[model samples]
Target: MTAVEEKLQLPRIYKQTVKMALYDLCIVGAGMMGSAAARHASEKSGVKVCLIGPQEPKIREIVSGNEVFGTHYDEGRIMRATATSPLWADLAKRSEERYRELENLSGVQFYHEIGALTVGTRYGQFIGRTKSSLKGGPKGYDNVEILAAKELNDKFPYLTFADNDEGIMEKSRAGYINPRKMVMAQIVVAVNQGCDVIRDIVLNIEKLQGVYKLTTERGKIIWTKKVLLATNAFTGMHQLLKNPVSYKAMPQTVTLAAVSENTAKRLSQMPVVLYEGKGGESWSKTYPRDSSDNIQFYLLPPIKYPDGKYYIKIGHSDDILKGSLELTDIRKWYSGKGDEELEEELFKLLDTIFHGVRFENHHGDACATMVTPGKQPYIDLLSPTLAVALGGNGYAAKSSDEIGRIAADLILTSKWTYDIPKENFKVKFHVPSKL
Candidate 1:
């Protein structure tokens, strides 16, 4: 191992009771996708499986150390079946169909199926493309209602939108999922199906004669017939693969504005909103291409947080700021507040959208998301004994259950069983010269 790897390595604890136990498959991440894959793999294949990943740190201070973090630590992630891509829309529709089933089976509640609204310029191609993608896609776009600015403003009086912008409201199978609770639900379901959960960070993976060896930070070793890498933003770390996969881990900031109970009640009918409109010069920079005309802001209604306060949260679309590919930089990035100027910009954006709503208090936090070349996840097998199902590209949270199901099916059956073409998710490897 290199000197940098040694500095982050955990001291090996030689367990006196150590025994080289074998598993049919071992998953290297226990986040949304990994946990869902574990549930599917164990329930469908009846194979001995192990899900390994460290639990989320109880406080933000722990991120100062060499710790792994998850973007699903938040209370809400947008859930919708309509998208610009047919594949994503299909994946989301499949996953949304199982929300009730998963909830009843695990006896956990994570989905709040209120509704979802997306507004964009009438002249832009986004609204038309989304509608077209949904016509022959999943759910047939019947539940989506197209409304002009007048009808939209009359329906959602609290929201302020430009006259030129139109809206699409998904009446069903769309809303927000509490990601933290969603992971818990998956873990519960997976555990009920006889999958072991290992709460430790994966330090290394090595291939043996017929199985792969997994080394945890605390020195626990597991042998499995196959391995699935769902490590997301941390995939390049730990040198699990011979060649690193091509992906970007971009820094993001979300601002949460606390609202009073009365204000929350007034906005109770608010649907998860995605608005594409103009951008300000200070925060919006043309990166990779001209994005000034394509700036998007996603908003989640007032949801109660762990602090017992109700707050509305908002985040900017990707490619607005530069990001890093270094493990050390990504780790350090999570230790502090994200772009302060961006946070202020979000505050103003929320005020402008919400009209007369007054926020009690607001704060910004740091997060990172993984993006792939095609903006779709890579659910492919690296080798006969090793597979990978990662790279959410920001759209995987709502579609995670379906993605996991596809991955589990691939790894267990060694077949591309999904209706979508396998070529759409082929993994590509390219190490970037600079972050």
Candidate 2:
């Protein structure tokens, strides 16, 4: 054959076989933690990183009917330094410290530093733990103050609390973050640092000759030296590790009450509030009638949604939505019509809190978080070449920057350099079926 004809044949030969792309590290589930890990690993370790995950479903005026849902697929998430545990408190502080830096680097506005309040009876277990956390957890918590009921009322006039209830205010470096924007910011940084982000779902992961091969839903193969699974609730649905990690995929429901623009403007200065019943009771009970029980509910300040209306978001604690969910269950819950009972309850609660304001609209959505038995995240070496970072225990979004750093640290050096106690986040495969 002629030389030109032979070259044409060579091109055809190369096209006959597919080449699998190799990466230094492959991260599955590019949610909050995975996205941050991709940014940190690529920038710090200077290795080729590939982040694989499905894009967040678009936010619609109606919460239901979404194709996919994630905990971080919302407009705002509370970012507070106060926590029931010192470990989480420190992690929140660490994550907050990097927020401004991330925003500047990515040119995305993600954090709102208004403030945060934890309200409950002074003797409540959560309040006591939060007080202790402020006392000993992090240095930036010096501005935290315990406010009496009267003081709370005087300061936050729009909020109504029980006569004996008090509030712990993280006066500075506490607020809400645009979670969707934050993930985009992290991905932007990662991409700028030469990390490749693949918009594909990971079907399975297999180990061959000390290297991990990830099989995607699109039938593509990826070979990597290490793999990090930050799949959160979806972790239970996938067998990514040689030894499976035990976790409960607890689904959480959050409701948002859209108020008039004037109302939102009036409540603009309000801080994120963790509103509890008199003695830390669930807010599910009719308020004012049964005010002497335990309740747990968190409130975010008015933030504009895509529907051109400002909404005040409130989410119930996982204790209320208690159950492990399968992948199909989560997808169905996300895409199905929202719960009318929950929406009504949210309206009643909002009416009780914001008395005179009229709610222009009301909506609700479902998201799931993986909770380990210890109520902390599991970041450990699953196998020789695979490390898993899952189970945010519902607090992963606010502390994700630090968790990501820890995950990347574990994968790169087999150890973490953070001051967080190893026992707090170390992997413990022995988990009970009931959380």
Candidate 3:
């Protein structure tokens, strides 16, 4: 017999078609939230969880190509306890506690305990509201310090603060995290706990005989007792239900700049800084001239990239170019170079804040943040078997672990069980469009 024929005939069992797989819970979109849900469901809920999503690109360089990129595929994300609302702050605190346990279990170091600073005008309403929400002393925060402008400048001399600006610093459990690594670590732990991870795009979801059937791009099928749509930007892209969930995808851009080794070292001890813009001011009027304005900007600490050069990432709260985007529009934007005007603005902002720190190579990428009309995540059951955990409002990354746990709990028990108020995360149907 020929070698090929002999090999083919060697094991008839090996050539047999595999049986269809069934999962207790099937999660789509294995990004930050979905991966954590898979891990929590498999480990804590003891369910047969299967996670489905495309593999992260090996090369994330800002190149021209036809590839869909994720917002969380970055070196670092700012994790802080200072939020506009107390519920959000509590969510961040809860997720911070879980970060330690996840690191120990997965043996992956992702969270950095450096610290975080939220700076605004001394009398700004933003700062006042944040401080008020964080009341109850240490019960609400860990070693929180409200620093005056002079005090902030004294501690972080490299940063430029307006004379009237003040900062709120959380001394513990606040800093940045390697979002890409954190997602991978969650998947690692989930797989170790008997969760199946699939690298495929889900095309459609349908219900047949009271079971959720997920159809993948590769023509594979999966049946699950419950389905969780943790997909962020691509939340309503698929026809997952008879009546699709509604969400608005707000496209945003982030710029990354590679600084000199000396500058990186100088900024090594600087905490994550959020330059809270004044309520209604322009960047040109607020930044170089004064640090108080309505142009919100945030900075992540120096993190080493694949090229061995440390780059500090900066993102604006308001998009330089604003509009609602669909999944295809977001993918097309990601396939091309980022916005030049936005990149230039970010570089200028960085230079102003860091006192003329020259950035060597600057590049940027496009990502979309989903938001409901109410500006909170919608975690509710679409049907008896289909549950969705969509809408981050561009501030959900730091609290994704708890959000994911909430998603899983909603799927397993068909109810919201987290300590957070159900109204904060409850899904609102038939809401008028904010666009």
- TM-score (all chains, Cα) for each model: 0.90, 0.88, 0.88
Q: Write the per-residue lDDT of candidate 2 for residues 1-435, one digit (tens) a residue.
A: 334324423422212233466788999988999999999999965588888887655543234343344678789988988888778778888999999999888877889999999998767776777877775543455778878989987998777787879888888899999898898789878877877877667878877887878897778799999888888877756555544577777767778888889999998899999865553222335632223446678899899986688999877766554356776687776664355576577667776776456787777876777888889888877554567788888887899999999898889776666666667777766542121
Instruction: Write one digit per residue (lDDT tens) for candidate 1, span 1-435.
Output: 333223223322111233467999899998899999998999965599888887777666643454788879899999997788888888998999998898887777889988999888886777777777776542455788888888988999888777778888998888999998788778777877878788788888887787787888888888889888899998887767866888888888889999999999888878999877543233334312225556688899999998889999999888567555577677766766788888888887777677668999899988788889889899997776678899898889999999899999899887788888999898888752111
- Model 3 pairs whose backbones collide: 277-293, 278-293, 278-294
- Please estimate how well model 1 matches the true structure, expressed as its whole-model Cα lDDT: 0.81
Clashing pairs in 2: 280-294, 280-295, 281-294, 281-295, 282-294, 282-295
Q: By lDDT, is 2 or 3 better?
A: 2
State each model's CA lDDT, in order.
0.81, 0.76, 0.75
Runs with alpha carbons beyond 4 Å of true place in candidate 3: 1-19, 44-46, 59-68, 137-142, 278-293, 319-321, 429-435
lDDT score for residue 320 of model 3: 42
- Residues forming the 10-long window of minimal summed lDDT in candidate 1: 7-16
Between candidates 1 and 3, name the one with more favorable lDDT.
1
Model 2 misplaced stretches (Cα beyond 4 Å)? 1-20, 59-68, 136-141, 279-292, 430-435
Ranking by lDDT: 1, 2, 3
